[model samples]
Target: MTAKLTDAPVRVMIVDDHEVVRRGIVTVIDASPSLSVVGEASTVDEALRRLPAVRPEVLIVDLQLPDGTGIDVMRRARELEPLQKMLVLTSFDDDSALRESRAVGASGMLLKSSRSRDIVVAIERVAEGLTVWPARAPEEDDELSATDQRIVELIGDGCTNKEIADELGIAEKTVKNRITAILHALGLQRRTQVAAREAARRRAGWK
Candidate 1:
């Protein structure tokens, strides 16, 4: 059975580059009597233009947009309507994207692989001002090696490889090599990015 929405019909806006995903989400949301898809946008520009007229209660957004990141759209929407609820629906589970989304005021995060019912539930939860994180297995302490953990900690402290090497009594070249390996393992690009992600992870109680 479909879950009943709140007393009033929940207005929703879908922002995704893929037409198929947009249609699928619209269908799922429209299936319920108390939820409606008021607008759909394929790009940040389109979303900005349409949102004013749609005036949705919740926005389901994808991270990778053709024009720009979905975070930009979320930021604009919040500026346009401070009370709007935003839920990030993206394939990117990277810590950087998650942190940026939260920093820009997304109410919840949902993986695209989530079931349609779960997506609907996420929308409702965010609409009610509750945050939801995609379920994941707990990480073991041993997941990262000692060297990797040290590098991560240093990165979180905003230390460059040269500084970390000087502090850790290691060769700067060795520090660089270790940092490269750590970035590859974490699927990250830069030290600052890692630092920001670490801050978000800490805030979210991931570690």
Candidate 2:
């Protein structure tokens, strides 16, 4: 299902350290009647203090703050108001930041250089409970032996250890051992992370 803004105008809060960026976002939001700026905070401490009074519907936040990271702000906000929607605006697009933001329940993410219209759209979408991220495809290739490649493919396909064993005519314990070895070789802590990395690689057009 798609998310939608409330019947009343969506109340928004800006959380960024940069004065110019904050002003720009405020200008874009204030220009629209469907959205309104309720408060602006340049630090985590400031945001925490203003949140209850502002009770914003959406938070447009940068990853970096003078006092703390956006992830920290999101976490604290969730504690204060679990239903508040969060949209991450950041210059950094590293995998760690992406994973961390999603883990902390950010609804959407946009590059800092995104057009004003796009930023507004992201805020609305996030307020509606939609995830906004760049499209990515699954990765199929890795620097592994043919057997390891087969194992990874099966894992990506969601095959259980016993199912993989059955498919390959091997013992379940052997399949488990093989999976452990593959994880070690790839230096990955989790199968899901490995799968995501592989998918990102494919999305980047790498072999």
Top model number, TM-score? 2
Q: Which lDDT tens digits does candidate 2 get at residues 1-207?
A: 124534777889999999998898899998877788999999989988998889888987889998889988899988888777888889866777877987888866778887888777767666655556543333313335677678777776777888889998999987776665555445465878766765665577665
lDDT for each of the candidates? 0.79, 0.76
TM-score of each: 0.62, 0.64
lDDT of 1 by residue, 1-207 (tens): 123355877889999999988898899999977688999999999999999999888998999999998999999998988777899988767778877987888876878787888778778767755556543333522344687677777887888888899888999988876665455445466777668866776787886
TM-score of 1: 0.62
lDDT leader: 1
Q: State each model's C-alpha RMSD to the native.
A: 14.8, 11.8
| Candidate 2 to native Cα RMSD, angstroms | 11.8
Runs of candidate 1 exceeding 4 Å displacement: 1-6, 135-207
